[model samples]
Target: MQCPQIVEPEKSTQARRHALWSTCSPPHQRNSPMATTCPARARVPLTLQRSHVCQCVFIRSPARVGAVVSRAEASTAERRKTAVNMRTPRRRRHRSLTATAAATAAIAALSTSAVAPALASDQPPVNIVEMTPELTKKMQHEVDTFFAKHDLPGLSVAVVTPARAGSDPVITTFVAGTPTLGSSELVDATTQFELGSETKVFTADLLAYLVATDRVSLDDPVQLFAPAGVEVPEWTDPQTGATTAITLGDLATHQAGLLDAPPNLGAGCGADPGCENPRPGYTQTMLWDAFAQPCLNGQPCPMYQPGTDWLYSDWGFGLLGTILANVLDPVIETEPPAYQSALDQAFLDALGMSSTELEFHGDGRLATPYKADGTNAFHWDNTNAISGAGGLISDATDMGTWVAAHLGYVPSTAPIGVQAMADTLQPISDITMSCSIPDQCGPAHFQMGLGWELHHAATHDVGAAWAFKNGLTDGSSTDTALAPSLRVGVTTMYNKRLSDTDQGLPLAITLLKLLVADQPAPEPAPSAAPQAALAESGQPTAELIVPGMMAAGFVAIGLLLIIRRRGHGRRSTR
Candidate 1:
């Protein structure tokens, strides 16, 4: 049957009628709000799984039904008015607007009233993540299990919630385990730890900020901006046998044809004797030399032509950092050299990343890295070479704020920073991925964005679902991810290094699922039957549609009156 907006009848009476219908109707006929909760699926013959069974519901006596529905709706409207009249009323603000503002507001209202209906796609998914004692208890147990599985010294996670009306955004900072095995120092959100490649997001964003300022274009050739005496190399793709122009954008998107690590990188007592060690760093000269060298592994990057292959390369970002450091040139005055100091000013200080140090400042507050056996290791730092790629330290709290800024949940950061964050989330590279077409079911299939990895559950658009970056060093593991559409961000830092940060991924994914997943379908409605039936059918009832329709009509009428009056004034003057 066609979906027609029917007047809502008396809630309880309607419920009784619907309940009778539901009890008698064939098992396949009842409406289900979500496929996940549908009972009809159980009755489906296994052989007929590929086919869909649609039960069409039809009602006779249209005139009689309409008459009853109209009268019930009238009574409901009256009861609503009576309730409003019984309540204490507050003064509503009605302000006179300037001529320009009035005209602008009228145009805006006209556009919104006219356009919003056509664009409404997803139902404004009700996202009520309960932080009840029971929920917290379960979450804590999961967190404990995750830490135990990884044998982490400690783990801290910060979840920034979506903003609600009349309430500030909520941040739940949960910390578990010990910062050190022998010591009693417990890790918390405030505990400092190296964020590693998570810093690359900021470096990529700095390039975006410069673009927004018209200082540089993403299309600018990397060779034009590389530091003096540093030379980035050319890559001839073995598969395609074509050389492509590399740009700053390529570096940001991991398409700059660079190796995974700088060439000359080795383990177990190298020529310089620090190569195999966990804390070794390189200078700008070393970085340039490494970029000029050939690829060590056969994955991609310097091994392949730019944009022809997708390779996760820290060396690509190292090139980007060199360009940014030279192009920006000590935007902040700090004890560090020109390049590092510029990075500090442009991002670290600008983002209020006080807890994130550009280099090891000998700060005792740093989280001590622990060996798998739980013995202490020297905290990792960076030299000018690799520091730009994965050399920044941050805590869970600041990382959350960084995520918040990226998702545009916070306006405290610089506007350029916001733009850059948005820019970085744009999916640019594609993995060898194939998904269920048309409706888009299946795993994310691993898409790449500028300095970020994108989770494409809903859409492939930048910031549509989640944008993420993860980091791992010999000392720590960190993951930062944001879902802009849901206005949620998750960040975690752990003292012990892990081969995989899948433990933290589950926590972050769980939080996001709570934000985006459809509400429990089988749950009874807060209102009685009429409204519940409408909701379950995916059809907005007359009662729900009428108020909005009325409001828009009223606003449009007001706008017409104002515009006419303004036109009259202008004509009279003329």
Candidate 2:
């Protein structure tokens, strides 16, 4: 009879052949026999008696197969099954894992890119001459003691020196206390605080710019800038009753015979009430009305001729700001801009003081001004309209840059040279104000510069006849000084009110001494171009001294490896 066609499935057929070959082998010699027989069966089934032979192979192999044959077939089938399983689901899992790993790697890279350097912690080690660790610690301790004694909320101090070619200027900064009592934020190098009368330095610089451009002269009379129909205050010689005019130089040096406040302070307000309107929100119309008023009942007329005596006057400085604004307009030709805009453009911008500004409101990083009692009830006075004299907000970091410029260690935006900065710090007039009695003024203990006060003979141990200024409002006090004798500069800002004679002056003296006592002797003047280049570049010398950038790179690389391993783990799961 014709054999029924044996349509063995390919997988089963192969398994049967494997089993048959394994059974024919001796138990002890199974490996050699099975290998030879399996190939012979494979050839015969495909070539001759294909249908019947294939059917017989499947049936006979299963019955007579050795224990080893069954085991071999089982093993082969299991391996094939495993391979199939591995190809489908396993392949999909591996692909999913690869995608996850790639995504994780990408996210890690993005995170690294987004993170900025920790500016506070990453400050390069500056080479401040003689700033030994011991001295730094002692200085910080003294500062802390002073703060506690004076009940101040916060303070910052910086010392900068001239830079030599290929070397960074020495800088040592110390910060103390919280920026505000109610917050956990520590004072950083960048905390913006009110600058008070320290603003005058920038104003004086603006005037220098005007002078450089020939827009205004130092000797120009005040009447030249006052608004039309505004009667200039008559300055009668105390003995002669003869009127004298004040010049721009007189205003700049506080020798303009201007009062401490606007004349309207007593007229519109009341007698001895001048302080009441110290920062009144006076408009242009109000200023005009106030200027028109006659001298008060008991108030003395101009005591000294313009350019004869040096007296402090915010009004004179305010008028200077207005004149600067007007002079700058013909050159810049813009409308409705602040009087200080010229200063911002001509000086602050060129100095890379990106954070300094004439006004600060709504900026969260700003240190809150506090009264002596630590209450935030005071607001900075904005009524000056003439903001150049006492309206600036700045951080220690930016002030450091300003100090560098003053030291001639950095270039200024103005065309004025080192001699010009020196001129600003020179003694313009001998200050003869009484220390104890009002009219019993003594010989000059202080002198006036263009916009600075010269301590020709400071009463403090640390200070050495420095160029200085101090500013105070209701709850803010600031002092900035350049000790040329020591080649050091310092700035201190506090958000609390203290007596001018007590807390403010003493602190200034102490900081000046701390900075001067430890400074190294000045090196000879460096080559001009190289020093100028360093100043112009403003790159911190610490960058070259510290390996911070290298360390950051290594950290970034380790982060990548960790991210990669996490991705591999996720991929394996898939």
Q: What are the lDDT figures for the candidates, one per model?
A: 0.55, 0.56
lDDT (Cα, 0-100) at 9 in candidate 2:
22
Question: What TM-score would every model get versus the actual structure?
Answer: 0.62, 0.61
Which one is best on lDDT? 2
Clashing pairs in 2: 23-66, 97-571, 462-513
The count of residue-pair clashes in candidate 2 stands at: 3
For candidate 2, the TM-score is 0.61
For model 2, how does the per-residue alpha-carbon lDDT over 259-337 read when each residue is reduced to its tens digit?
A: 6666664333334443443343544444445556543344543445777666677767876776676666532222222
Give the lDDT of residue 511 in candidate 2: 65
At residue 574, give the lDDT of candidate 2.
84
lDDT comparing candidate 1 with the true structure:
0.55
lDDT of 2 at 517: 65
Query: Which tens-of-lDDT digit does each residue in 289-405 have in candidate 1?
Result: 665555653443355456655566777786677667766674221122354555544444434345565646474556778655566655556545556687788766456556655
